[model samples]
Target: MKRALLLLIFAMPASLSLAACAAAQQTQAPSLAKRPIEGRFDVAPPAIVIPPPGPLPSDLAGRLARWEADAASGQQAFAAERDATAALVAAAAGAPVASERWVVAQQAISRLTAARAPLSGALADIDRLYIERTVDEAVDGLPDIYALRDRIAEMESAQDAILQALSAALPGQ
Candidate 1:
């Protein structure tokens, strides 16, 4: 009776361990053949398209035109002033600061800076319009506004470069 009792206790645990090991082996084994995926894996997502913007409103269009014209005129005036200043700066390159030529050169530089006002004003107006359009959710006119702004900005940069070069050319700069 004692021997049978001890054998039952030890055999019970061994039988349970064997059962667990067999279940693990079955789950870990690879399948003999690969199955096809349930759905189309190569399918592409739909493309997104955005339509081009329409014309700007009449009022905004007129304002942009006026600003563009103003920038053009300003660019012309700046070019003239830049040339004059460049010549003056060249003449005063080695002159003393208190000499007449140096004084004239300084005055020319001042006028050159003043000549950029119209272009600056146009850029400022365009910036205001852009802000207003964005705030009002008027997106249709943004492209034109941006185009004008970019053009004016380039002109302004060129003027600035000229100004820098002229200033640097002056004596005791």
Candidate 2:
């Protein structure tokens, strides 16, 4: 009797589920042919027209000038530091790791690394301006911005080469 009751309980749900599925299958979905048409699908979307960019603002132009000047100064300072660091590295090349000369050379290398900050900052600012103008669809100052960025990048690359040479010259590096 208990077995029959268990079978009945299980069969009841199974039967109900089967019946529900059958009923669902028997119900017909509304035909697409019978539905009313909406808007016309044949026409193409309108073209978007972007206006040409005008002249750069005076303040922005001044900022670019200042950045360029700062980059040039930084490059000069970097060149001086690189030369000094190279001399120190050469002097320390044969010195003991714990020697004062070696320590001073390491400090000079650190200073050389620090000198790159201005160039990097200028590059970052130029990149930000480029992105902002690009996003705003403004193309006026992009040429100048790009030229400055390239110049800064070249300066940075030259600085990096000097630093690498000096670092490689140092003992125990």
Report the number of the highest-TM-score candidate: 1
Measured over all alpha carbons after superposition, the RMSD of each candidate to the real structure, in angstroms, is 6.4, 5.8
Residues forming the 10-long window of minimal summed lDDT in candidate 1: 32-41
Candidate 2 stretches with Cα past 4 Å from truth are 1-54
Write model 1 residue lDDT over 86-164, tens digit each, in one string: 8999999999987999999999999989988899999999999999888987888789889989999999998888888
- Each candidate's lDDT (Cα)? 0.89, 0.85
Clashes per candidate (backbone, < 3 Å): 0, 0
Candidate 2 lDDT over 1-173, as tens digits, reads 99999999999999999999999999997777633455456578899897655677676899899789888888877877887888888899999886999999999999988887888788788889889989997788777788888998898888888888888888788
**Model 2, backbone clash pairs (residues 3+ apart or across chains), number:** 0
Tell me the deviation in Å of residue 126 in model 2: 1.2
Q: Please list all clashing residue pairs in model 2, or write none if there are none.
A: none
Candidate 2 lDDT at 139 equals: 86
Q: Residue 154: error of model 1 in Å?
A: 1.8
lDDT, residue 90, model 2: 87
